[model samples]
Target chain A: MNHVIEIDGLTKDYGEGRGVFDVNLTVEPGEIFGLVGINGSGKTTTIRHLMGYLRPQKGTCSIEGRNCWKHAAELKKHIGHVPGEISFPDVRTGMDFFNLQARYLGIRDKTRVNSLIDRFNLDASAPLKRMSKGMKQKTAIVAGFMADAPILLLDEGTTGLDPLMQKVFTELVQEEKAQGRTMFMSSHMFDELEATCDRVAFLKEGRIIDVVDMSLLGGNEPVKEYKVEFTSDEDYQTFLAQSFLVKRHRDDYKQVSVLLSDRDLNALFASLSGLDVRYITQVPRTLEDQFKEKYQESEGTNHAY
Target chain B: MPINSALLRQTTRENVTLWGVLTAVQCLLVGVIGMTAPIAAAGIAYYNMLPGIFMGVYAITVGNKLISSQVDRGTLAYVLSNPVKRSTVIVTQVVFFAGSLLAMCTLSAVAHSLGAYFSTFGANSAEIQTIFKLNLGLFTLALSFAGIVFAASCLFNLSKYTIAVGGGIVCAFLLFPIMAMFGSKFAFLSNLTVVSLYKVGSIMASGTGWAWDLVILAAIGLVAFAAGGVAFVRRDLPL
Candidate 1:
């Protein structure tokens, strides 16, 4: 299938180990694809290349089959972007800046822009210079989405946003996806990606080490992990001997983490009935946990959590 | 259109204040000098030096603001992310810069002419022509200075580098002419700088010979502007 966005063997070496290296990814139509990495992990560099702000040192990237570098301006007609940095052009207020952008994008309709402004609950009257980081980010978000372009390339689009606002952003992303828009967003925030992305790529030391399809990850899995603590060591030891898969156990705390499929959930509760059970809580297998495991494994270090 | 009118409007809004203040000061200086002093005296005293300094300062600051400072601040990313092309942005800015400079010189010329026309001595057409020639020469020299700084502005992502190189070139040009004033040995220094091409002496002497120098100054400006525009369009922007 032809990708909405395709990056193949894309490399941009800023020297001293500071650039993206031979990265490859493709976002299908209506998919929300994410690039996740720590700071300086080449996320922004990759986005900039897609934005055509940098020429690839090796290989090429394209949007809708057209080269990003050669057809950047033309491609912009169908794409919206939120730069990593939030500095705005010389404009007094957020509304003015949006108006200017609207003019450039040639969007005569203010309905989408006004709706986005309202949805974000942004006070467009505030002076941009005085706006806080979160406010500026919201302004950038509104600008990026207001164009209603079919594709968006966002570099850390949720930085400085409050948790509630981040939810709003994710909901916005989901809504856009429902409308059949494709997004290629980069963020270090795992939860944001986990909530919305269909697939997430882990970028480490300038290279894409892994791209995990979200459907295959924890939340969608049939198996679940539960951490149970027993009042007595005998109960903990006995629980460990059960048919349940023991993911890990703590001797001092008398706790055992059990992995059980949904069908075995009744069996788990039935067996735990006789034990001097203190507390039993489900341990969610989050994307952070998965990323942490992969991240540590790739670094050849133990960042035990 | 190669020029985005919306971007042009934004660029003009950002720059008009500075252009206004500088243009006002230049016009006032030319007017006051022409009103009180003779053409030959004003040519040597005012036109030969002061206007060049003002232009140099204005050119250095605005040239950076036009392209390099935007790139440095990462604001250019916002501009570029839109449907607007790099050539569109560069060309629109150049049009604004060239237009503003042209307007500055034109206004100053009018002020000088009016000042001489209303002076107690009531200047002749010959002397009035000299005022226009002097300001015209000043305009071309400043435009060339604008071009150099603009090229520097386009070539670098940092304003410090743009100011250092572009501002440095204008300063050197302005300095060379003053250094030439010290003595005969330094007289050769005037030939080394573009400011000398303004030729206040030649214009004050007569209008005929100074036209070629003005053409050279204009040509230098065109070339610099072209190089800067091409560099901005072709080079990779970190933004």
Candidate 2:
């Protein structure tokens, strides 16, 4: 199967150790691939390479089997992009901008543009200079998606959108996915990717640390975690001594969070039977938790986005 | 060169205001002087410095706005994201820059021509030819200034740097010739700048020698404009 977007050993060095290095990714046709990283983690840099705005110091990027840098102008016809930074050209209003883009794309039909304005709840008549951040983001979103291109490369597309609007954007992405449009989006928002992406890649210090299959995420895993607090220090020590996988331990609070498979549930209960416990509750693990763990594993520090 | 009509329209809309103001100012200055004073007396004063200053202002400001300002603002992403190539964009801007400057000079030439024709001290054919020639020389000079600035605009990613280098060069060119007027010792400074190529004294005296100078000016503009466009096409855009 041919990948809609393929990046091989992509590298861009900005000096002082501040650029993407040996990054590789491939998005299967029609798949929604997500890139999640903290600020300065090379998310934007990677997207810029795909956009052909910056030439990679090494390696190459291709979309629909054409080199991104070599065939940038031709390839862009089928790709919709929401840049990391949004800046409207010299135009009077949002409508003027949309119209200008339509001209560039040779889209004479006004119906698609008008429908997009209505869908985003944008005041197309409002001057671009007076627009709020959220409004500007909506305009960029509309521009990126309005063409109904077969592929989308969105770099932090929903920066200033409200929660409700982000939901609208998510629904739009899902709708586009249903129509078999390939999407490769980068975001700092974990839940957004979790909700829409088929697979997500984590980038750290300009290199991809991991690529996770959404199916292997905590929500679908049979291995559940339970946080248990003991009534006394002796019980806490006794519970810790039990060979269950200890995911977390708080000695001062007499709490131990243990991971247990469905088949091991009976064994966990038998072990706690003789112990005096204060309370036990299921502790849900999310992508955020996994990301934090991965981040700390590599950096040995608890910095998070 | 490929030129997108939409981009051309947008470029025109972005720059027409400054072009209009400067062209009108030039036409007014030339018209008033040619109509009110004798052609020979007003020729040196009007053609020598005022038009050059106006051209400098227009070229410096509009040249920066054409390329570097759009990139600096990141607005160019919208254009580049479309199917249009970077070559098409730079070419379209060059067309706008060259065309607008030509129009500005042509209109001012017509204004001065009519002003001289209708003046109480009616002009001869030689004087009328000098007026047209002087404006033609101004047009080439403006092109040269714009070309240098356009190249700077394409070479840099920021508008400030474009203005500092390109605009700075043009301002220096305009100032050098004026500074040389202070004394013969400073006259050598005039040769250092491109504006000296205009040779207003030669043009005003109906000498054919000024035509060759205009060719050099035109060549500079063409070379600079082409260099700017090629630079824009070859370099990486942050957009």
Candidate 3:
């Protein structure tokens, strides 16, 4: 796969208190790559470096084989960037901004611009200051899409959007993916990412703790969650003691839910051959669960966010 | 050329509302001031009142806002993210602003020349030339102020700090000459300020002093622009 963005040992320090440390990551061409992390995880910093808004203090970040800082204008031609905050001059209407951006990007497609306006449901006549957060976000997104650049760098693109707009955005991203455009998105929302991104890199304190390929994780053997209803309390206790499955939750003496991997499930069935078995229901691991596990393992602590 | 025009169009479009209102207010103030004192009226007609007023306001208003607005509106990140070089952006902004100021100054000079010709005590050819020189000197002063402020704005990211430093620098330039007049020993101090250039222009329509002032202004403007470009190129923008 062609790598669209390649970052190696990128470091940025804002005084002594804040900034990103040596960071490395890559986004392949035509892939929707997600950067997932909590607030202050250096997600935005990395995006800034990739977009050439910030020069890396050390190492290199390149887009399409061009070092972003050194070849910013050339790299910018191939990339469309959306900042975390969408702000424009209060005096300019949406149409004015669109016209300026279109002219700058050398776009002459009025139909495409109008189509984007319709897709995002933005009011072209309204001044930028009057638009709602979601509308502003849509404007920025439309502007990015209008550039028709091969790469899209979005920093927390869906933070302020409502659920409906978020869904629309996800669909729009999917559409872009279909067109073979590469998207590198930094978002705190795991569910939104799970819906669209092909792969995700989990960043923790400026370092990528895990990079999960969604396809591989989703293709892993489906682990079935079974809550065996025992006839007697003693039988339940005996079965629980013998079972090697990871206990997820326990409600009562006779009621317990445990997560079982494929091998554990097979062993569980073989062991409970004679006992009355309860109905078995399959529960697949979500991206959130996988992420939580990785985060916990990496940090050696459970953080509830 | 088209790209440059497009960028110029963007800057013009963004500033139209504010600059339009400011220009109107300045014209009104000049008219009102012209009516107050007869001698001052001759000064206005002969010395080109509009350019002086416009330059003063433009230096304080648009000059201060040029870079501060980018940081205030959070569009700096988006603009800097583009493929364009940092130096290109700085140069474009400086040239656009300086060109605009020059145009206004030239127009005001023409208007003053006409106003003097039609006034009760009309200005002669020499007076018209002197007014022209004063306007030119003022334009350079304003342009230099813009450059200095632009540099300050770039050096400091915070809008409040940029404004403070920019305003303080301009104020110092304006006040140093007045303060130097009080003490004979301190008279030389005025030579260090941009106000000295304006004084020389007012005294001599065509002289080596004005030429030196223009050169110094251009050099300072170039240095300010270069510093801003370097800072922008080197500093990491907050994402």
Candidate 4:
């Protein structure tokens, strides 16, 4: 029940309703809480407040009961962060920056450092200015995680990383989670959040619309969806007459997408036994769909991804 | 101290090439040029004003880049991510500025002393002492100018605004004296700037009050430098 991080009525109004508005959330110790949202959705703003880089106008963000702004220098001792935009110091090479960070953080052991380099396939000897975006991202990842702080704040954590690197980054996050590091991550990738987070919050236009437990989307009582296409119009019409929730129906294609509990699957298949069915496939239910369902009507005009 | 060392090393390494070029140019202008001309006039004209102005310009460049531009470029975010306080970062920047000023001024003074030594064929210790004092005045004066720019760098986030305001004030300080040459009415405007205090002919004529000049320069430099640290601590960075 102890919250490692907590935000209470935090608000910063940047005029024209642009900034975060009355956001409240708590992150318990060892919880990998995810903030999933599209661009310009106040993810960075919220994280900035937690980092004590931005002051809140209305409320407070606290780490272990200490005010973030008042005790920023103290709080930073236990936190590691990766910003959305990465700009390194004016050092000559990646190695130079790494050395500088190590000195600044007072970290001496190079064992974890070398392992991160090997994992990311980073050539730290190259000049920082000459490094590519992916290399820079990898370098930032290593620097942020190298300190091994108990808390991590990552804003768009996997941005600019290639798919292969992203997979590596996700695996690294899982490893960090296993070690009980409390993390607050903002990412546009739903699958990443789905794979790693215990709970994910959906934000839109600087407001938190919902916070969902990922475990609820799985577990004992599961809701499964299946799309059934009938060979003719009569079978499609007959299937729709049965006691099944039709999520979507395309009359032209003679297809009916139905949502039902696992208990209803026997009745559904038995009813379809005599039907002229062309194809039946289970539709994957994902965090993306759950997010869309929450705010689809209100945000219909906004391009999500 | 670690923050100071890391930032200082990075800044010094980044600027070594430029510093080397400036030092060579100072050697040529202050060292080689003073060897041929009449010592007093050359001291007032080339040694006092030229190198002093160059030092001011260099201060402006370094002060602008050290903090404000770094914030604009997003590097300050990384610095702030560390456990170091924002006030400590400003202190580290101030240390870097002072170190750079010391390095640049020491090399220039040595170069000018070599010129004065050769101009007198290695005989007049008095003239070399005078050059040292002159360069000391120039270094302090440049520090005052750089201090103003440092405060501006801390106050503003954008480099263009910092440069415009900082560069504008320093340029006015340098140019007002030049404008005074065309008319007597404008001479009062030149007196208001720090560069006006470096009038070598009058300082040489007075012979002993360089202490007051040094005090004024140091006071202005220290006050501005202190103000920069305070401003950086209180102000919100765009990071």
Candidate 5:
């Protein structure tokens, strides 16, 4: 796989303030990689380092095999970055900002810019200072997309958008992905990432705790959850004896829920073959739960891989 | 060169109008003063000193903030992120500030010279030329002060107290000649005085050349400028 971003032992400190410590991660080309963390968990600081806004005190951060600080201008040309905070002086209108950014990026696509403005439902003539937060976010989104760079680095890109706007943003990301764009989005919202990102890196206390491939959750053999209603105590005891069961919750002896891993689900079903299976529901784990598990594991030890 | 031209055009359009209007207003006020009192034409030279002093003080106080505001506003990162070199940004700032100062000083000098030319009774050609030469020297002296202070501002991120102290130090330097006249025995302090350059100008006005002093002062200004450029390229922007 062609890696678009390669961060190796990237460490930065802010003189007694909070910053990243020995972060390492690789984002592949055309992949949507999510960086999930709470506020002040070094998400912004890491993004800043990637954007070449801050130099790492130790280690290296490279984009497409180019050192970020040494080759910032060249790297920036291929990376469209949206800062966590969207702030422009009062004089710049949405259109004016687009024009300025386009000129700077050396993009001559008037059609692309117009399409982005229309799709985002942004008032091109509205001054940024006078616009609402949602409108400003839309404007920033338009600018980021209009650059048409191979990589998109979004820092809290969905903060002020409404639900419909967020849906539009997801659609836009899909379109970018279709065009083979690599997107690295840092967000606090797991659902957004769940719907869009292929992989996620869970960050906690200035370190990456876990890196998960969402596609691996259910491989050829799918993990399934079953809420079995036992007729008597004998049935419950028989199900508990099976080794494929990963977790079981039994409030009373009548009903019990079992969570099985993908590998063990087939064996578990074989044990229940020819028996009256009350109900077999294949429920996938929500991104929130997976993220929580990763976060929990990361709190005790560093498990970035 | 094209990119530099485009950047320069943008900066000029933004800064020139304000600088021009203020300069015109100062010139008109001085012209009115010189025209109203013909016998006090010698005093008009002293009156011209007011605006020159104001310009020096304003440049020292405002130049650093103007350059540093780009960093504060987060625009410096955006600009640096472009394909332009760090040297280009520093050079652009120096050119912008220098051009604005030169334009304003030229306008002020012309207005003051014309006022002095028309108002003086029995004034010879030599006297008029001498006064013009003095004003030119004054402009250079004032620009040097601005350049030095601008360099200092770029060198250190001054706090409120530091700014106050800088202002106090500048005021003392400008007022050193007056202080020296009042029985201060520290004769070596004259070398540190900008007003002493005006005396040099006065002496040189009578067909003499203080080329060595001018060369030394020009070297000081150039050094300050070079230092400002070095500081700009090395200082990390606020994250």
Candidate 6:
């Protein structure tokens, strides 16, 4: 499959259901993959395995066909990483850190660094220990993206950035994506994942629930969902008796959510004609909604899998 | 070597201020006391006890902060993310630390020589040689102490545990000698500490046994540092 990053049965058991279990994943070249999970759900654990910071207990993680643990130093040359926690060294200022990193990474070009600083509006002259949380995050972002490596790994990539800065960061990521750079990122914000990821994996209780292709959720002719509240009780009953699929309903508010394919718009309009409707609004079926559905479905099965 | 260069520079810059203060205190102690007290007594107090204690403190600080503290605070991930081997990081720290100790010891020796010349009203070659031998003993002792704490740093993931065990052993090494000075009963305790390997009075009296002292001290240092390297390479970092 020409996978740039591969994990086969990677398991690290900290005991008491606290670690990743048999996580198998493959990220193809130039693919933007996203890992979505709440805190302590093994997202960071999986990323640390990929970074070679933690050794797997059972299986192997590799990058470009080299074992992550055995050839970590060599593999690092091809990877740029932004850790979940931002902790700078004892360097006096951000510029000092950047220069140190440049020398360590053997990067002779400083132009990329200066441009990243300008794009993020970062103050590289300020002392690292004294910088605010947002500034520290921005500095880490600049450092990670400046090298322009073919493969990038970011854990909670935009946690502390303000809305405007988050927009800038996502724009930078999109540009990297457009250049065919392979990326694996984890985030708490579903919108960020939906905006940049080709495929997103949901992790729950240290297990991967599913990996969803964004295209499958309706690419060009995406399915549309709507919530309509009929003004009259009789109209609401009549609409409920129709053949349209009612995904959810609120009896008190006389509102029902209906899922329809893009081609079914005319049929939907015809079905609603001459009906006393109070209001109708489109319901965006986001990554969060998918995540919630997966969780609910899993619970409903009662360990059927 | 390139990977180590940047790390060395950063460590040196962060450590210079505290090192400067230690150096000034050391130079002043040997330079001032050597002019007033008997040369032998001055060497024992300023050269043997004072610098030994200071070096012990410095060794523990470097040993703990250089690796374990960074790991505990999650900062080591940044350094390891670069194209640097784990072995390279530990080796670079040991080299930088040993060089700093050697420089401080040499400066102490120079300060001691200056004091001895003024006290004797002439340049006493014999006293200067005695100071040089004593400084060598102190440097090796310092190296041994550093290796011990550094090994502790490598064996543990948490800085608190490293500091507790490493700092406790160093404290005992420092205290045993001070207590031994009171009487003969406590003198046996000195043999249990590295400070006993540095026989300042006996070395100055005979002038020929300093070779064996250096060898033993070097042996202690090499063994401890090698053990530390193995532990660090084999250990799994939680970051």
Second chain TM-score, each model: 0.95, 0.97, 0.79, 0.92, 0.77, 0.93
Compared with the true structure, the alpha-carbon lDDT of candidate 3 equals 0.72
Q: Pick the TM-score winner.
A: 2
Docking class of 4: medium
Clash pairs of candidate 1?
none
The residue-by-residue lDDT of candidate 4 on A131-182, one tens digit each, is 8988999999988898999999998888888999999999999999999999
Runs in model 4 lying further than 4 Å from the true structure: A218-239, A242-244, A251-284, A300-305, B1-3, B37-39, B121-126, B206-208
State the lDDT at A43 in candidate 6: 93
- lDDT tens digits, residues B4-54, model 4? 566666677766776678767877777776676655777766755677668
The clash numbers for all candidates, in the given order, read 0, 0, 1, 0, 0, 0
Write the residue-wise lDDT of candidate 5 on B13-71 in tens digits. Answer: 55666677668886786566545554234444463356656665666555654455445
lDDT of 6 by residue, B106-162 (tens): 998898789878875544788788888888888899988988888898888899988
Candidate 3 per-residue lDDT over residues B118-157, each given as its tens digit: 6666667876776566567767777777777777777766
lDDT of 3 by residue, A64-134 (tens): 88898778877888888888877764346889888877776777878887988887778988878788888
Q: Point out the worst 10-residue segment of candidate 5 chain A by lDDT.
A: A216-225
Question: For candidate 1, lDDT tens digit of each residue in A1-305?
Answer: 98999999998888999898999888898899999999999999999889989989899999999999989999999999998998899999999999999888888899998999999899999999999999999999999998989999999999999999999999999999999999999998888998899999999989987888888666455788888999999988888888888989999999988888889999999999999999988877777887887887877743443
Please state the CAPRI-style docking class of candidate 5.
acceptable
Listed in order, each prediction's TM-score against the native is 0.92, 0.92, 0.88, 0.89, 0.85, 0.91
- On lDDT, the stronger of 2 and 4 is 2
Candidate 6 residue-wise lDDT at A165 = 94
Q: What are the C-alpha RMSDs, in order, of all predicted structures?
A: 3.2, 3.1, 3.7, 3.4, 4.0, 2.8
Candidates, DockQ: 0.75, 0.75, 0.58, 0.56, 0.38, 0.68
